[model samples]
Target chain A: MAYEQSVYLTGDHELVEEFGLLCYQAGYRVTGTAHPGPVRRKLPVFFRKSTLVPRSATVAMELTNVRTDLKRKNLKFLDGALPKGALLLSSSVTVAAHEQASWIAHPERLIGIAALPTFGGRKLIEMAPAPQTGKDALARSQAFFTRLNKEVAVIQDRVGMVLPRMVCMVINEACFAAGENVATPADIDTAMKLGTNYPSGPIEWANAIGFHQVTAVLEALYRDLGEERYRIAPLLRHFAGGNRWWET
Target chain B: MGTGIAYAAALASMDALLYDVTAEALERGFGKLRADIRQSVEKGKLSPERSEEILSRIRTTGALADLAPCGAVIEAIVEDLAVKQELFRTLSGICASDAILATNTSSLSVTAIASGVSSPERVVGMHFFNPAHIMKLVEIVEGHQTSPDALAAARGLAEAMGKKPVMAKDTPGFIVNRVARPFYGEALRLLGEGVTTAEEIDRIARLEGNFKMGPFELMDLIGIDINFAVTKSMYEQTFGEPRYRPHIIQQQMVHAGLLGRKTKRGFYSYPP
Candidate 1:
């Protein structure tokens, strides 16, 4: 178990930067950080993954928003020169660990972790490991999270994992219900908070986590599972696409 | 459920006639209600005199006619649609025409329960969460034929009982139960998939998500059998939508008689 003490972090999303900072605060030496600008639209396939980090590092954390394709593209590039014994924890809330790992030759080394926008303030890491993930890799992943003083729930490799999947879908449903005039956003939020004892209403939760990310998780789940249950509410998608429903 | 509703009504200063199938069953309900109010008094949440006063307001009876003079008759019985329909039909015939007939049902359709009654508009759903006297939220669900007056009356009753009432259509699971499905379903599915232990999920939800209780913890407190039944009902009502689908893990737990706190066993074991 020769785990590296230094970690290479990539991606420009706030989640990525915050996660990197969490690792640093947890005492891991972060060697490099990469904020690939708008790579989702250009040079996605031609990028050299090796040039993004020091070759000596044994761990790389890839953090991206719900644009799962970008994570998949990064995994494909890293497949060529993925260091031996190195682990890749991709911050993907929508894509399944198995699906993302499929792009890499060593799927056993890939784990998908749900990085909520509020994750930096918390001490829990929601982990989803690919089916092919080896016991050593799983243990090493757990060790990484433990080092951050974070409790870990290594869930089955599924899209959206547990909390994010459930929460995002809740937000989507609220958006749908609001669109149909079933209830107002405030009413729905209040009903959920008072009715079910949820910590926050779905719409307010979306506001905190960013509506763009909520819609992204739903869209990815719909695309990956092809289920009507995962369909994004048109209202949520509209809001995510620069259409503001409120002053905020 | 009947005892819970009776307790809530008693605490609200409403004289309640608790009717059950037999004298023995009604006595048992009374015993539980007494113990609950006593516990509250012991905890200083309720004064002993007030507990006694609340208890004095409740009268137990096995006769259907005993409920005839009440302004509101809330039925909390078996969850079967047929059973509920028959009961509501009988209550509609026996009670005053203007009296509100509310079903304390979590899953069955309020409209269907009212369909066989004489005036379907008088029937509505007053859904109370478990341990009704403690949980603050009450769902006042409107059936298809439910009159606005009936809805208002039910809401008023909930408010009078010091409960927060949320209006919902007669949709499956109403608002809370329907929206809360994923919380338990996803957690159980993750456990079945061996992605994480139930303890881990529970810990993360409480500590990280700041939930009052973890999914597994709440399920255990609510009773696995009760939760599973709600899931099955929602799935059936939703036409087998994947979201409301019950996990096999929970079904297996229920089958094994691991029905949560009542059974002293569930996702986590409890000391008897």
Candidate 2:
């Protein structure tokens, strides 16, 4: 596939760094430095503003922003930068399906993809279409991730996408098990890791991905879905609210 | 009853007195424990020396009075409530004053058992899962009048035995059994609605939901009768909460005695 340019809008240092590397390997012209001032950048191109991208660019990649205050402003910038025929892929941790759908000027051009910045080996992208999203836009979005050799799962748009939603529930259950004293944190982790063959224990995984991100997904589900099963454990809420893990 | 409990108690290094109404029951329990220990040693999970030491600490007797000196007695006998209460009353008089009476009842109410004894304050529920040496969870249930010191002692013993102790307030099914009901109930609901086949549901739960096993398969492994009984208990405890209600399909299977792998038929049929 031939493309004029690929723009990435993200504040996550890990994704920014990893995508910079991915762009280099894929031989695509990458624009946009996270910072306003340049500091020995290695990508083919860098721009501080989203509007600086040329009209010929066919793809725009967006990653999650964890900071609560900057999300709306970042989404506005993303909305303005998307070209008429361009495909918009969001890998946001905090962005919900409704919010993503609403942010696109041409909702038919938007597609949601879930990726964990920490695991850069391969990404799990879940495509969600807004009510106005055209089939052509969805196919182009799917093709883009396919070209990158990324795994994809098409799911209904709720929040946290698929893998993150499922994993968050597992982590929530683990925390509830710990809080109720069903098992020690270590033994529960050990049992799940050994007995169940999970890639990692829920607690350790939460710590690596940041507990706040897990809590955000859970709370969003609880709010959007209005189901008791989605209720966040009290201990998770406590930890996410600034109580240290050891303190609990 | 005696075999699983005796092996668990022995493996925990507790000096256990295995009592039975007859000598045959005592002998059977002891024989099973010895065989289990030998198997563990063969598997390299238990050393031969440690297995012998554990077996030597277990004393088998036919007399109820033989348990008089023990600090805690766990009755892993039949699930009949009347029989358990009668046993508790007898042990209350024979055991020492400070000895904490514990029941290994998994389904019955802990409070009901404690009611049978005169000094109910000393009674606690120490529920260990099957093959207790391996499964790590131990629900430490506190009856209405169970003393703080008694609960503490049970928790301390569980910790010493390398088991994780969780305290439950004498509720039906405790934590794991109660919280885990939806795992089975929801899967059955999906099956009944014709949303997916049993195998597909199992695969989706494992691959998509990340569960170790699907509800139907786990129920089959645990036996349909046992799973149905648990569902009934939770439903009755909660006064027929729709969430924990038993499915009709499960009742039909149990009525037919197609109780999973044990009877070679359940959600799926198996060879005897």
Candidate 3:
């Protein structure tokens, strides 16, 4: 089937690889792929018989761009490179994609989707629209994920979005409990699983999602809302900075 | 008067000296414990001989001095800080210096209570949930000066009682109370904001959020007065953080003495 929109992706994780492969299979053009450096060569254009193919898709995977300065520069380079109406989808946890949407030729065409590299088997895709994103952009975002056989849940434009937000809050509470020795990590997880039937105890969830990401969400929530309830636990903050209490 | 804590304490084979300011309170507590043991024996939950042995381990006393010889003393007294401090002050002087002085205070600051004692190092908060014998989580709180050995001993004792011990630093509401605040506060805020009714909020939390009980129902069971007191303590301890702020609706309910099932009136009406 012929595709109507071109999608550009940025991220080097498993989600990026899977999403790029899905886009290719779904008849979208793979205009360029960049990891840590600039795409220095022209992208290969696949053509069908007797006519010039309308190359509508431009998917770029920028996963290795970790430094904030380099990331900002790379995003600017991508913004200048994509054709008009090209959709920019970001799957990076460090940089909120919506923040860079305005720099594009069509600001309203950009949407941010939370990406899970490991748990990508689940069909649920959390979609958040940037402040400048229009209705068409939102629909395109939904359709893009839908094409990949993913179900989408739309949420407010906030760091961590919905599931991550709710899950992070639970983890934050659990960390506070663990920090205080309210219960051993094993028992805390056990009580939640046994007593309340949570999918995973907060500590295990933190370990799975990476403590830094959890701490970032908490710190963001605290900073944005200035609420003490969202204050990052000392243990979580310490872990984010690669420190453990037991070592000290 | 509750049978759970006393029965579990007896089952753990710790010599329990149940004390109250009045003899009637002690009698009621002991009677309830005895009835529970008898039922266990009849149901084969405990052998008749073991039931007798369990009963032998618990002694009732009105005098504070009776707690002196005990290796560890858990004060499940009234929640008032002044009263708790006074009791601890008395217990500190009466009990052996080596004995671990523990308060079963769920909401009050363990640090504040420890501060009242000459040997704050010996003071620790051993917060057991209501129906303590049934609830498995025991918060073992360490005050600023609480010795590592003291904390370890408290943890060991909690395990000895077959309770899961979680370490918590001395903070308002400690872990459970502090972390669990939003469960009630957000529900009340939803009520005040007119986002949802009390019944609907409770229903959503149970059905959607997967809480066993809604905030309002749990508040009623815990008593409006007690819940309000905990919220106020957390707010005050956090220097009046807005997130932990107490709602006026709860304060009004307490003023009305609609303290849930105990008073037969709260968020819902109950028949006595």
* Candidate 3, A87-201: lDDT as tens digits: 6665434455566565556667666665543334454666667788888767766776677776665655655444444556767777766776655677667555533335566
RMSD of each: 5.5, 6.4, 7.7
lDDT of 2 by residue, B1-272 (tens): 65676666677787778888988877877787788788889999888899888988788888899888898888788888899999999999999989999988878888898886988988999888777767676778888899999999898887877787767767667655655565576567556655446775565445544567766788899998999999898889868755578889899989999898888888888975
Higher-ranked by lDDT: 2 or 3: 2
State the lDDT of candidate 3 residue by residue for B1-272, as single tens digits: 23456666778887777778899888888887788778878899889899999899888888889878988888887778898888888888998899999988877877788777988899998877766766777778888889998899999998998888877777777666766666677667547755446776555445434456777998998899988988898888778877678999999999999999899999999987
DockQ per candidate? 0.36, 0.11, 0.13
Error of 2 at A194 (Å): 9.0
Chain A TM-score from candidate 2:
0.79
Q: What tier of docking accuracy does candidate 2 attain?
A: incorrect
Candidate 2 DockQ score? Answer: 0.11
Count of backbone clashes for each model? 3, 3, 11
Kindly report which residue stretches of model 1 are placed more than 4 angstroms away from their true locations once superposed.
A1-12, A20-60, A72-88, A96-111, A128-147, A173-184, A226-228, A242-248, B270-272
